[model samples]
Target: MASKYRRGFDITRDSLRVFTREPSLLLLPALSFLAVGSAFAVLAAILFQQGLVESVVTNDLYKYGALFCAIAISSSVATFFNAAVVHCAAQLFEGNSTSVRDGLAAAWRARRQIAVWAVVAATLGTVLYILDEKFGVVGSLTRAVFNLAWALLTYFIVPVIVLDQRRKLRDQLRRSGSLFRETWGESVSATLGVSFIFLLVALPGVALGVAGYFILDGVLAVGALVGGGGIVVTAIVGSQTASAIVRTALYRYATTGEQVGPFDGRDPDTVFPEN
Candidate 1:
């Protein structure tokens, strides 16, 4: 356990170092969030204007259907940006200079794969949502288990899609699952470290928001809200960028038997022990 934790910490620290070297990698998540938010806003406006929102809200079937569609759209946007980030991270690992524009271009080239993955993800998400809403404690527990499993299984899918454009979606999924199973320990450890760092970074923002609500009023409160929000956003972007870097590095090590950047000192076999 100690060894696992140490490995996770090293990987997380190295990921942050990569982010410090190329802070622009953070822009991918910000752009994705903005694009998806805008799309959802437009969708909401259209639904409201057409009275579709009211109908959907009143009917469970319509609500789930609309939710599924929204989730699919959002997933596509997320996959596109995630692929771009992975591409840029791969370039960085290779010691090649890259930019946000270059990353975006790579994602655009893999748009079809992104769309297909998005549909698959959205369907899964919709089913999980339905399970949680329709069933009681058992359903919620099942959804949670499935969600975690899904996350682990697909951890390397973005990198696969970014690196191997010619492979079909099913092939990528199979490869991702195989890779993750082989590196499950490292994957769990890395996730633990990232989650710990995220909590640490986000705590200040949460405190500030709570204090603002309790002690401040009017303009001061508004200022506090904005400040808190900005801090949270910064933490989120930083954590996400670090995560992408670490994930790409792990995937590269798994497939190529070559460690890059922060991974150079670590033994690839140890990092991804046999299942």
Candidate 2:
């Protein structure tokens, strides 16, 4: 277990090196957040204008349907941006320079697949939300386990969607599942390593917030809170960027049997040793 953690941490470090070289990759995810938030805002505005907010809130069916629509919109926007990230990252690994515009263009090309996958994602998410709301703790536990499985199973979905010509969602998911089975260790470890490291990194921000509330005064406290919030947000974005890069690297290796860029010196065997 310790060895696995170390390998995962090493992969995260390598991903960070890739990130340092082209920090603009961060812009993609930042844009994703903005895009998703804007999508939800627009959705809310539409609901309000239609005077459906009350019905959505008061009726379970309407509520779930509205939730599904909202989730679908956010999912589509996020998937589009994630496709951009995967496209840009793949280009970087291929020894080619890529820009945000180029990445967005690539995602735009795959917009149909993104739309289909978004509906699938939104459906699953809505079901989980309903289960949690209906059954409490048991539902929450089931949702968590199912969510993790779904995440691992679809780990390579964005890369596949962005790079492959497959139109059907099943075909893309099958490819992703195949790649996950081939490199499950590295994939899981990379996720754990990144999550652990970022959790630790975000702790100081949490501490700052606490200190501001208890030890600091007035404007200083507000400043500390704002600074702390900024740090936390940055950490969240950094973690997302690092994870996407590592995923792209893993996908490239699984598909091409070659690791490039920051992955040049890493031994493939060690990274994905025979089980």
**Predicted structure with the largest TM-score when compared to the true one:** 1
Can you write out model 2's per-residue Cα lDDT over 143-174, one digit (the tens) per residue? 99999999988999988998876899989999
Worst 10 residues of 1 by lDDT: 266-275
Per-prediction TM-score to the true structure, in the order listed: 0.88, 0.86
**Poorest stretch of ten by lDDT in candidate 2:** 266-275
User: CA lDDT of each candidate?
Assistant: 0.81, 0.84
Clashes of each: 0, 0
Taking every candidate in turn, the Cα RMSD to the unseen true structure, in Å, is: 3.0, 3.1
101-211: candidate 1 lDDT, tens digit per residue: 999999999998898898899899999988998898988999999998889889988888989664587799898999898777766666677767677778888888887
Clashes of 1: 0
Superposed model 2: Cα runs more than 4 Å off? 1-9, 19-21, 44-58, 136-138, 210-217, 268-275
Q: Which pairs in model 1 have colliding backbones? A: none
Q: What lDDT is obtained when candidate 2 is compared to the true structure?
A: 0.84
Q: Candidate 1 versus the native: TM-score?
A: 0.88
